[model samples]
Target: MRGLDDHTYRKRTAALKAKRHDCWLCGDPIDYTLPWKHKMAFTADHIQPRSKGGHIYGEIRAAHRSCNSSRSNRVTTVTTAPKTALRW
Candidate 1:
């Protein structure tokens, strides 16, 4: 994520809080009131990350904070290349 100003961050946070506490990616409920140590804490995530030209507020999603942080901006590869495939 880019260096967001405090005001921007707070504004975004407020908007997110008003939305339903559900994981936008998977449609799972996010228990924000629960303690983080209990593995049920909620977090705001960008559907498309800022590094990939995603708008912070326009494409936001709720997720387990840990899940969001762990995903970071790595592209997910579902299929592995064959070991014998020639190099490009």
Candidate 2:
């Protein structure tokens, strides 16, 4: 995102928001009208992190500001434990 100009950045962010997608990280609704600094505000997140050599214009997804900040630049993967019945 370093070389991306303000216009392009705005355009990209707008496009992402226009998709009306849920937060990719937290799976929650995004409040498009919220202020930029607000935790639940809409944000454009790179599917692959920029700090991890992801392209500036690479695949982008909608996310809440808080979710995006919490993810940082780490690789994302899903881990689920084997299903088992539990007795109370």
Candidate 3:
């Protein structure tokens, strides 16, 4: 996988955090103050998976560290199931 260097990663994270974007994966707020290893910590995720031949400097979106790691190079689509009510 094409991983980012420490400087690039931190730079990207800071930029995203400054924008106050929600995690594109799980739609949760990123805790930029948290340590890098924290589950809620901010991370930059590739718009396309690197394992699928995505470019190293391609578009990226903000994500939580755990959410990004859980994706694990798989293509993901986040959707919440619609709520249904029973009719008597």
Candidate 4:
């Protein structure tokens, strides 16, 4: 997250709010009303990731703090188990 200061983060948050975009890591809605430190609060996400020499800009997207942390620097898919009927 180098080069991505608070100013850039604010801009990304505003952009996401304006467009009403969903978090890339999770499909849940981001609650901008919450404080930035909140888990569900809006945060900047790097699509390419910063750990793999990926810059902190350009490929950036909006996401929730929890989502970004869960996703980390790698791509992942999250899903729930399918419901099943109980035997009589």
Stretches off by above 4 angstroms in model 2 are 1-5, 78-88
1 or 3, which is superior by lDDT? Answer: 3
87 in model 4: Cα distance from truth in Å? 35
lDDT of 3: 0.78
TM-score of 1: 0.58
Q: Worst ten-residue run, lDDT, model 3? A: 79-88
Q: Among these predicted structures, which one has the highest lDDT?
A: 2
Models 1 onward score TM values of 0.58, 0.77, 0.70, 0.66
Q: Which is superior by TM-score, 2 or 3?
A: 2
- Per TM-score, the best of the predicted structures is 2
Q: Which digits, one per residue and each the tens of the lDDT, describe model 4 over residues 1-88?
A: 3355767866765776777566766666777788989999888787777787776555666689988898888954436532335754
lDDT of each: 0.65, 0.80, 0.78, 0.72
All models, RMSD in angstroms: 10.8, 6.4, 6.5, 7.2
Candidate rank order under TM-score: 2, 3, 4, 1
**lDDT by residue for model 2 over 1-88, one digit each (tens)?**
3455667877887877888887777776788889999999988988889899987777888889988899999877536432335854
Q: Kindly report which residue pairs in candidate 1 clash with one another.
A: none
Which ranges of candidate 1 are over 4 A from the true structure? 1-4, 36-38, 55-58, 75-88
Among residues 3 or more apart in sequence or in different chains, the pairs in candidate 4 whose N, CA or C atoms overlap within 3 Å are none
